[model samples]
Target: MKILIADDDPSSILYLQDMLGEWGYEVEVAVDGNAAAEILRRSDGPLLAILDSMMPGMDGIDVCRGIRQSDTERYVYMIILTSRVESEFIVAAMNAGADDFISKPFNDEEMRVRVRAGRRIVELGEQLRRRASRDALTNIYNRGAIIEILEKELSRQGRSQHAVSILFCDVDNFKAINDTHGHLAGDEVLRVLARRMAATLRPYDSFGRYGGEEMLGVFPDCGLEGALEVAERMRAAVAEAPVKTEFGDIDVTVSIGLATVDKDQTCKLATLLQRADDALYRAKANGKNCITIAH
Candidate 1:
């Protein structure tokens, strides 16, 4: 694991680095809290940090608070190390978002135990984040998560001039499958279709479950024609396969609607989603299973 040790004292920094390096951790050192914050802002930070409570300009507590405010992949497991262990000091550290605490003139065994516990917390946080972003049944991105991603992508387009297309899809005759067989059969079909669509799409193309019987896909850097081709391929894949279920083999089909991002559009994500949904309705009305590009 990568570890960051921030202290103004040279001797203390070297001692902690040598101790952690001996324990098989890759260590990086910063002279003060300001330097530590700069290091975190520059590179992807270490999983765990050992910060001295008192330092020059931007103390350890301030640094920790800044990190908590920033949205980054580094889940910093911070251990506030200081000579003072008063109740107020401990409470201050906790409020500043310290994951663990260690007193100066530290015992080696206690430091090791605290660092190990911090690592466990980082692992647990990563697992929880993954679960929150993923669909339970199809293993695709969930509705809430993909909507968040869409907003980010839209913001990026405003700043960087990148183009994106949104495709909304609904499984045709899904309710009929449930009525004829069962909900389990319908679920199996949906799961299988999701997997197949994901496999066929490009790596940058993202697909997600948008609620019951509906899925949404976002293709970054793709225009109307490209999205139409993708929709056609996905439609063919679903029609060609027979989904296996407990009841029997079930045939499934999908209708897709495509919408390209316009340079002059001032609409929000919900408006874009509504347009795709309207196009999807047109696809269903024209035929049970086909692709429709929104005008």
Candidate 2:
């Protein structure tokens, strides 16, 4: 495991480095709290941090607070090393997001055990996040997950000035199909449509079920014209493919709406979705099985 040691005492920092290194861990040291915080902010970071309670320019508690505040995937197992063992001091460390605690003049075996336990907690947290963010039916992102991803992508693209497009699609006459063929058939159709859309799009492009019989797609680095082409292809594919059921072959068509992100446009995912939805209504108005572009 990779470990970070942050302590104002040079001797303590050296002791940690030597012990952890002998235990087959890669160790990085920070002399004070500010340096530790900077190291945590980097793209590559340590799996755990052993922070001293007293440090200059920001205490270990403040450093822990900052780490918890950032949205980073690398789990920081913070162990606060301090002489203070009062109830209030322990509570304060916990409140500041300390994962574990070690008294000053730490026992080597105890420290190792605590770090191992912290790793388990980090794994559980990751698993829970994945389960919460995924769609149960399609296994693609649900509306909430898609919106979160959209917001992040928008923020990233804003800084980079990259192009991105949104495609809103609906199964044409889906209600009629469900009423005629049964809900089971409707479900199969939705699953098949999702799979087909995923196959057609690039690996980086995101697809999700926006709601019942509706799907949302995000194509990064794609302009309006390219998005329209993609939407047209998807619409044609759906029209051509016939879903087979116990009843018989059921043909389906899809209506699509395309919108591109720009500097002037609102960055909010909901606003982008609304624009795409408006375009989808226009598509339905113009014709049932066609693509419409939103300006």
For lDDT, the strongest prediction is 1
Estimate the TM-score of every prediction: 0.71, 0.64
Put down candidate 1 lDDT per residue, 13-60, tens digits, no spaces: 888989999988999899888889887765367878999999988788
lDDT of 1 at 126: 76
Candidate 2: residue pairs that collide:
none
Residue pairs with backbone overlap in model 1: none
Could you say which candidate leads in TM-score?
Answer: 1
Off by over 4 Å in 1: 1-59, 71-76, 81-92, 103-109, 126-136, 199-206, 219-240, 262-265, 285-289
- Tell me model 1's lDDT, rounded to 2 decimals: 0.86
Against the true structure, candidate 1 reaches a TM-score of 0.71
Task: State in Å the error of residue 284, model 1.
Answer: 2.9
